[model samples]
Target: MAAPFLYSAWVAASMVLVPFAALTETRKLRRAGVSVARAHEKLGHATEPRPSAGPLVWFHAASVGESLSVLALIGRMGQALPQAHFLITSGTATSARLVASRLPPRTVHQFAPFDAPGPLNRFLNHWRPDAAIFVESEIWPQMLRRTHARGAKMALLNARLSARSIAGWQKRPKLARYLFEVFDLILTQNDQMAEAMVAMHAPPDRVARGINLKSMSDPLPVDEDALFEARAALSHRPVWIASSTHEGEEQTVLAAHHRLLKTHPDLHLILAPRHPERGDAVMRLIDTAGLSATRRTRGEHPGAQVYLADTMGELGTWYALGDIVFLGGSLRPIGGHNPFEVAQSGAIALSGPHVTNFDETYDAMVEAGAARIVKDSQDLAATVDSLLNDTDARDTARAAARSFTESQTDQLDTIAERLIKALELAP
Candidate 1:
């Protein structure tokens, strides 16, 4: 099929705007202290040379969560295809830093090129990826079309779409089909998403239900020294973490912590906000809630009523300190953050009612007695108290959580094999 008119128009507009986009994005990255050469990657200027002999498999994800989710898959694929070189691309410097620490064997990381002819051409020509795998919701039409044009097999893995996105695509059915048809396979997060893809005109045979890649994400790396120091500072104080809390959710977390403090006066709440930049605002909230707090960025010990874990990349240590955890972002319809980390840390997860992002995972967890749903401050407080007091119940929940996370790992090899065959990545 010929390219849709909308897609062609988009390409034309992008040709004019790409230079400005590259300049602006590179400038932002540079100001964030990225090296000039690395920042220019936004323009498809790769810092590393592509390997000369091996088949190159490219994985592209949007940011930190998406980027990290694919590492285990890459590891599995690398084991299967020992000679294949892997390239993983994303747009954020933060993701680059994190991924650098956990990159799979024979894998290289780069900032993805802007989806314009000049950058994409430069990128495609240099790498010449044999196969391209795009992660959840990263459907840049130009990128897909250009990659397909290059004769590379492509797969859309861990695909997810909001209802609003489906409605928008439904309006441009031809363009939707045109883009969806580029992928050799489309593995969705759930059956509903598979149906959504089909409704948007993706070939029915190409779309299939797949596990949530985020649920299968590699366990967060823990800092042993930090964990030990934190444990000593807390000195057996009852602890529960309210992790990845957002703006509206913190007030409720604080209220619940306040109620818990009345009974378990020595209870410690490590409040790790989703964005570390929100530390100051969260500190003010802690003050208003009449809770004594200490900031992690300030290097304070976790002795206060609330330990403000408002720094990036330290959630693993926090998760280790608590047996009971209330994952935030579910309370106010923000969808929930990953519960996999909580389960991996061997903690019982308590989440609010709205966890659409991880709905399938959360549902299975609740049904298996691995997680509980709390509605508000009162509910959250009661659940935490019960878990803290009841060792048998807490242990059982933790066991269930471990069991669930372990079971998910068994599917990784199967998924990896499927992708290997679908994208023709195997030797």
Candidate 2:
């Protein structure tokens, strides 16, 4: 009854493929093509305590957004399973840094082993986790094969897959089935994601309990000194935040800022690009737009400073500094970023129609009238201007944002219970 070919094909594919990549990518560790997992081994989880006896659970998240969500989940899960140990792996330097600061006392932070067979084999042999939980859409062939082979139960939490992604996976049935078979459970974020998983042939019992729990991430800790410095320098300019912006979104923001300057000359724009590496490129974009911008790295807060929030793990503090918060990546084709923290920070939350990444959060906010959606460039500028200029409108939106942000009640506990059940742990 067991599917042996599926397992063999996945492992063989990884064994043949990953070595060529490891050799090439090891040369370029920090750049665009470099593997984040490789760089993390150099940075050290060398200090992490070796896993001891009962029910070692390993959770893997790909990048900043996914990692933060799982970090919160790990904390909740740890409280319920005091006897269990946890291995938390995230695939970005930013994510690793965030995990180091925020992970629970029982959790260990490491880079997830690459999808290649040899490394994955070594990883599983060493850590030997009894259960694995993957956040988001990580479906690496060898990692799943090795975990399943070693008799570790796997689950996907707060998971999502786009329609386009589903169609692509459907084309590769062998690979898709291999990935699907690995996860004992596939807990999705929304109905749309659930439907997509079914289309990709995820087994009936393996997928269920689809709900968007990512809206409940613990707010990133505020850097009090930096926030105080920024507040002191800005001298009461009506400020709007543009959080987690992608490429085209910045242009839209700059255009909107140009228009807003006509009505409120002292209005400041705070831009936080999605990628930290793109921070300098965004500063150049600001320069080219003829807007005075100041990078967060500079200690002196120059006059006419549209603060470029380039630092990591301070999104909460940045949101608090704003009179209006425009959740970026939505105004453009980029799938949008987490705006839940913006609402939590009590900033009047503004987003656009392209919020597929955080659709469940968007739905909750829109239904609660906690957030507003802008249709285009003009709409974005108008909404932000209205929020900034009208205290009543801003207060209404801020209250709604906070209300909806607070609505996600104990999702982590629910997820942890299901994960334990899937692992067949003693109740």
Q: What is the lDDT of residue 14 in candidate 2?
A: 63
Candidate 2: 10-residue stretch with minimal lDDT: 38-47
Error of 1 at 380 (Å): 0.4
lDDT of 1 by residue, 368-420 (tens): 88899999999999999988889999999999999999899778988999999
The reply for model 2, stretches above 4 Å from the true place, is 1-10, 30-47, 171-178, 302-305
What are the RMSD figures for all models against the true structure?
A: 1.0, 3.0
- The sequence of per-residue lDDT tens digits that candidate 2 reaches over residues 258-326 is 889989999888887877678888888888888988777765463474778786777777777775888
Candidate 1: 10-residue stretch with minimal lDDT: 37-46
Q: In terms of lDDT, which candidate is strongest? A: 1
Angstrom error of the Cα, residue 85, model 1: value is: 1.5
Query: Which residue runs of candidate 1 sit more than 4 Å off their true CA positions?
Result: none
